[model samples]
Target: MTILTIPITFDKSHLITIGEKLYSESIELIRELVNNAYDADATSVRVTIAEDEIIVQDNGSGMDEQGLRQYFNIGSTEKRQHNRSPKFNRIRIGEFGIGKFATLAACGRFEVTSRKDNFAATVTFDKEEWEQSNNHWHLPMRLEAPEILKTNGTTVKLNKLYKKFKLDDVERRILEGVPIKAEHFEVYLNNKKISARFLAGQRIPVFEGSEYGIISGELILVSNTNFIVGGPGIEIKVKGVTIKRDLFGMEINFPQLNLLTGEIHADFLPITSDRTGFIKDSPGYHEFNKVMRGVLQRVLHDIKYWQKQKEKKKNRRIVNATVDKVLNALKKNPELASLIGLPVSPEEEKQKTEGEILPKKPRVKRTPAQKRMVSKILGPSAVVARLKIGKKGISCQLDHFGQDSPESYTESNIIYINLDHPLYVREAKNRERLIVNVARLLTQELTLLKNPKNARQAFDTQSKLLKDTLIDTTP
Candidate 1:
């Protein structure tokens, strides 16, 4: 029996289709090229954008003829085999050699010129010409003298561009996509150096060991709300290159998550061909997802704690402002102060003495035991406000008493308001209602001190005092 040999092959158009699909954004090509330079042990990469062309030049270990041949070989395993740079020993950023195809998505023609030791050459690939040449598999190259390159490095010139590239857009892409934080590596766009985006906030350092590798980096809870303009998520990186920004399914409606931004590095995480997502079925990614879920749980807890603290501070301010308004109103109404058994100014006292109708009772001071009981009821966590009424000082304390407790009670100069009262807890949902409820409780306690027997007169006095105190005095 005779056997026939066959080989798998694809059309040139398939190459173009793969490239366009792999690199959906034209700006992504810049990241691919920059990463290529990084893997070459480059110290610096300069990207120049012009009206009609874009140039990427890097000071790295340039390729020789054989190296250039391997570079053009699609899906070459050379980089995967030797995963570190010879010069700087950097963990190579490029895995699948097919990344070079990404250039076709942005330009009609691209040229690569490199010089290493005594070898120097330039290879040009024109998309239009390559497609027209039915079965041609070779590209045009020109040998140049070593002096042409000046030093060892590579320069990629993308000509016949399909679209215009703004410097700001390119810089932003590099900041997010490239690993500018790598040691001894720098990227420049339009002569301006591109640096890693810095977030100012509480940074939680993460260093967890997974079965695949170590998942390490910092997660920042940005303090400035203005800086939270862009999309919110943490960038997942492999081998220093950012693969994608993700929340790992921990996304929620919490506003604090909007301020979340940082990077997580897991070199062993298996990424898809486009590098836009992870291969979820892989064991490496499973472990990574599990670890991230645990980390985010802690982050969520911190965000909740931060939110509570902020609300607590805001509530304290509101309480102080409300108390100040009440004190100011009390000073303006001497009649109200007299009925509440509170001391008034000396001038008001002189006028009241001149027209004395009812006999006055001397103010009674509290004993040490009563003071201790007030302190115990208020508790350490209670919110306290203090103000002076003429020469006497008054203290207002808010604390949680059982629902059966009275709304408020006065002990000497101290008034304790029950926060857990049915009315208070119900009205606390609205700030205005909360202020009114507190004022009503204060009026009840103060009025009871002077006229405990006359309910009708006491209610009338409280209504008058509350009307005056709750007036819109804020200007």
Candidate 2:
């Protein structure tokens, strides 16, 4: 392979945009700066909060003015694959080489101070530079000379913020947005330190059998119960239990983001899990998608997971609001019908749902007899669909009869049985408990029938069917 050389332009115009992204309205700025601090081998990065300003101070090997010019240069290739080294076992988070731009997106003014090899420097830029240049894309305004400190580190101060969101108020939210753990670095909002916590959780069932690759990936604090998958493929581990996983919806960002977030852990990158983990857009991300879909294809998958937590939170509000309306309607009507599944007028639905939800009807208690009857109707062997239970016998149909003392017993499905047809006798090849129960009931009715011959024939046929079912089920 031959080294390819191409002339790349570096001018004042491009420099100003270097840290532009870090100043966005909705974008995450601290995450970008924190990545930079990590790259500099900083084990401790502190976010300092001052009135109307935000500052990020790190104890990493600081940058001299020249180093600052090069490293902070927009689109600088200084972070070539060969020269760069990550200080931790964590995955890579900065890919565009413009993460610092996040500052410009959030604040109207920015400044940096650093010291390296006993040399110190400071650089500051403001909205005036951008406005004065007519947005000509000038290099970031450099004020480096007598650095703020002779110490070995850097401090980034963002001032004149957009104020759409207050730094002092949203520190926790910002901390939550970060993908790393709090133990990695101390985050502060307005001088008050903010502690981080993991997302909520529930029992995540592993694949029934064996896993395909490695388990025990990186840990990410996405949201309570939602951000379990991390590192290579997507794994979750605790003590003796480790789940092997693959493709997360995050792979969808691979094509556009390129390895912006590196494998935060050895278990996560799956160098052994998949060779393509480092290479973007290979089968890795796509494979990740396949795995994600497999885990989330079911409806309740989201009950314990999130494809994109940000989007999920937004959508959850909509669903909750609708449920609240339904509950309110039930409260006003004193009947479930007016609130649930009833085709009342739109005006009625709106009006009836104005009241607050009452305490859930104190859960109607059931007597043992009621429970027994319910067990029979909703038991594992209950015959679903339309069925007539009478002194004559049981006739399978499409409608349920209000029988055996009930509140108009009707259901689209029974508890455990999934028989597609009502009177279909050969339906269950394996001995189904419900089929046997129906046969037994048929036998008892035959014993009491006026005509014994017809009942006897039916019993014989059912007994044979039962025998066949028993054989199949036994095998």
Candidate 3:
């Protein structure tokens, strides 16, 4: 094998292009700058929006001349090597050393003023001058004494804005973007405080680990609403900073999922330079997704069960109303009353018909798979209900007069569902509605059992109503 080394060079325009294309929105530009402030150990950051300029001032340790040199270096790994911010021990969010140019994306010219131990230096970047220069160009730096009396901090001023950003939007984005709730940190936009509010729901702890430290977060199901608000879905936070908000992407497309919101704190996952999303192929990112998918499935199952309970309650009321109406109508009409009778007792009838001639039994030809499935379902004598998926059919059994019967009789509390049946196959696609249908069938059976004398009358009345509805809807 031969050893090879190549020096890579970058065009100034291309370097500028990456920064300009890094963010999709004007709010994202502000977010990146604020994150820079956070990485600098700034406890408080104030953003001021003027008609032609934007100013971000942070009360944190200011940069010295050496730090200034590294800051302007396009791909400097200084922050990665240093790792954490001084004084506060905050995790550094920027490593590529190109975040400063993000401001240049929004403006033609921008300046960084820093003060450290009565020593101050100001650096300015002029896009026009850089464009007119040779391939080699550098941001102009001016070292001087302090002009203003701020002891130790940094201030960034962006002049000649490329695009207008609404102050209110800037505040909203900051609130959603950064981890404002971290102790001792505060963000102010146009003098208004920007803070993070926890979602209103049952808090669920989420934790995972890799070569890095343990990653943790909370998965919550907010109250009342079926969709998440403020910061919907999950936020992927690395070192107490948001890398991607709504991490699940479209929230598994569930309305109740809107009630489901979470914050995933996994700094181990690597992100692209833009920081809008994670590198999907990374081992750490894959593990994070696997864990999150499990959490999402569990939450969805819980939501499904909860929905079923609510629907069951509502349907029970409807069943009771229908039963009452049938009983009342039967009492009012003599002809209907005559049709209502107590169900027959199979055991007593069998004893009385011992001398009668037996009828020929019909032979049923069932496939081996069907026979196996039937055995599996009927094997458990204690099981009151079962739903079996098979070829094109729906057969339900209701417990008749508290008596045990053969599998062939519709006298046990079991429901068999053939998924191959076109109607049920369509309903299966919608899980929520399918659950409701199953519950409705069970509720109807239970309602009949409650008033067995009126069951016939109630069933007849329902059948007539259904027929009338079918006729009315027919073209």
Q: What is the lDDT of residue 393 in candidate 2?
A: 14
TM-score of 1: 0.81
Cα distance off (Å), candidate 3, residue 248: 4.7
Error of 1 at 451 (Å): 5.1
TM-scores vs. true structure, each candidate: 0.81, 0.45, 0.65
Backbone clashes in candidate 3 total: 4
Model 3 lDDT, residue 242, Cα? 71
Candidate 3 residue-wise lDDT, 14-80, digit = tens: 7668777776654577877888888888888999988998999987777888877766777888789
lDDT of 2 by residue, 335-430 (tens): 222312332456655564444222223344765534544455442223332111111112221112223333221112111122233432243333
Cα lDDT of all candidates, in order? 0.79, 0.45, 0.63
Candidate 3, residue 128: lDDT: 81
Residue-level lDDT for 94 in candidate 1: 82
What lDDT is obtained when candidate 2 is compared to the true structure? 0.45
Give candidate 2 misplaced runs (Cα > 4 Å): 1-27, 80-90, 130-151, 167-169, 182-184, 198-200, 205-283, 297-475
Query: Candidate 2: deviation at residue 78, Å?
Result: 3.7
